[model samples]
Target: MWRESSNIGRNQTSSYYVDNTLKHSFSNKTTAKQKSNDLKMPQPDEPYYCSQQIQIPPALPDILKQFTKAAIRTQPKDVLGWSAAYFRALANGETPPVKERLEMPVATQKTDTGLTPGLLRILNKQLGPRKTVDLNIIEEKWKDLALPKEQFDELVRIGGFGGTIEWLRYFALGCSALGENITDAMKTVCEILTADPDGGPSRIPFPLFKDLYTYLAKVDGEISQEHINEVTSHLQYYVDKQEGYVQPRNFTSPDCPKLS
Candidate 1:
């Protein structure tokens, strides 16, 4: 009887130990899984794809940095008149009147100012005799002139109504005509923008131009006058502000850089 009691007691103890061991194993596995899951989870504040704080540097020049000061220092009315004249010519599809050509000082003349008689002749020959010209031609000719940067600076000062957006667009056009080396200029602008985070007066123009060019380039054939008007109307808002200011809406595309 005592032996029977001992056997029964031993069996009970063995059964309890087995059950406790299984419970412990399951609890340990569940704890490990939960810890692994916690490690894999992302923090609430972290960005899933790219950080919002990561900014694309401004792709522009030092001249743009002092744009307000440069603008304030110079006579805006003269600049506005120049942009208006070009805008009006573009709007009317008329030949821009040849203003009395002034010889740029030798230092400035080395750059293609788009105001030169040779450039004017090229403009008339290609675009037909119109008072307002398509600004894209400036891009087409930048490389052939041998001094694109200087010429681009002149175009920025004179064309598109004085916006960073317009100047960048015009610059992009020039870069496209010149080919990939143009990207170096674009990177320069990006560097400038990155350095100066403030929406400084120096405008970024390529982003908008690429957008316009892509839409314009995709047309099956010649761009119709209607198309010209639509583009001009959109561009005018910025141009009217300064013969060169480019609109922000023009740069709202990720594919703009590839448009060239």
Candidate 2:
């Protein structure tokens, strides 16, 4: 009876030990599998897959390079905002808000009205081709530049505009808004239209100046028609001598009637 009891106890202990060993081994394997999953990268055997539908564009590299350079040159205050505008313009086949060159910082306390010569130039390049542009098109371009809606509203009200408008008149109005007075406004227009270098005389074709000036003067409602005729006539002499190019100086000089 003692020998049988000893055998029974030993068998029970052995069975317990075996069960514990198997449980421990299974727990280790489970832990190791979890750790492997945690540490291992997905798809280790094949890092890249060649899919028939996934084709890279050939011009993508150049496009990205240009975008990077534009970002650097533009130095936009709102990265995400400007990027959205840039790509949106690109997709729509409109002029992107890119500066011709990087702008140097100037120390002026004057408030920025969100319109600059460069920005205005971009708008002109975009909308100038058409003699008339729809109000919606103008709004879209304005939004692309991220200009204030209030200013646009003010301009529309100033012109008493409706669905469509003559682009030059609006452009003249834009120049008026840009400058402090009629002369200053005209100067800004000349600068924008001029092919001259920065800080140059900012000469433009006399015919264009006459048209812009005539429109501005008519809107002013203060200048006499005779005075407008007198100014254009005086500038004609210089315009002829200078290969049909009359600069801001021709009319801005004291000899000519004041634009104001």
Candidate 3:
């Protein structure tokens, strides 16, 4: 009698456990279904807004037109990235990164880096007026050009630039990095800085050339200041005849003393 009662109790306990488990599982399913229904999209019967309620900004069309024209002229490599830069500049009321005109894609391919003369000219137009520029600002501008971060870092490292850097000095260093040698670098600099028409002899003031040449030579640590002074002194006579203008021809002439 005792054994039979014990077996009956066990069966009852097992049945209760099964029932409780099924009830808990069903409760969870019910709660999950309710939550999912809460998140489900409305059916066709429900409409959030009618088409007549939609509105557009009045200036959007003109803004988009200008943006399209800029994109067409700039010919940016990364449209999405450049677009972000363009919008950010507009929002902040700052100058946007853009090329003045379209250039052959191969203009920068000479150095196999993206630092083309036209791009540099654009950068100059924006940043040249400032004597010293913030490094963070330069990095932002560099990204807008879709230039390699590594190359930017390299220039910064080579210049040993800090929070604020001299713009002309940085510009000179950029020319150095862009060219094969010091002469080539100076030539590029003159071309970029000249007031003469495009494809004409790119001449910069001799005094300005003197300053840049002296600065770059001192930075190089290869040539002595005395040697640099001597070369500039020799060029001064030629510059005198030309009303203080120095061109690549002044340095590359047959009679000109070669720089070591």
Say which candidate scores most in lDDT. Answer: 3
Candidate 2 residues 64-128, lDDT tens each?
A: 89888988876666677778888888998977777777766532313466766666777888888
- Model 1 misses residue 170 by how many Å? 15
Between prediction 1 and prediction 2, the one with superior TM-score is 2
TM-score of each: 0.20, 0.74, 0.72
Cα-based lDDT for every prediction = 0.44, 0.82, 0.84
TM-score of candidate 3 relative to the true fold: 0.72
Residue 5 of model 1, lDDT score:
100
Error of 3 at 143 (Å): 1.3
Ranking by lDDT: 3, 2, 1
The residue-level lDDT of candidate 1 at 208 comes to 43
In the range 1-260, model 3's lDDT, one tens digit per residue, is 99999999999999999999999999999999999999998778856887789787899999999999889888888999999989898898877877777877544234677887777877787688887999898887888889888888988888899899988888888888777678877888898999999888899999899889888887888988788877898899989898889999888787776654
Q: Which is better, 1 or 3, measured by lDDT?
A: 3
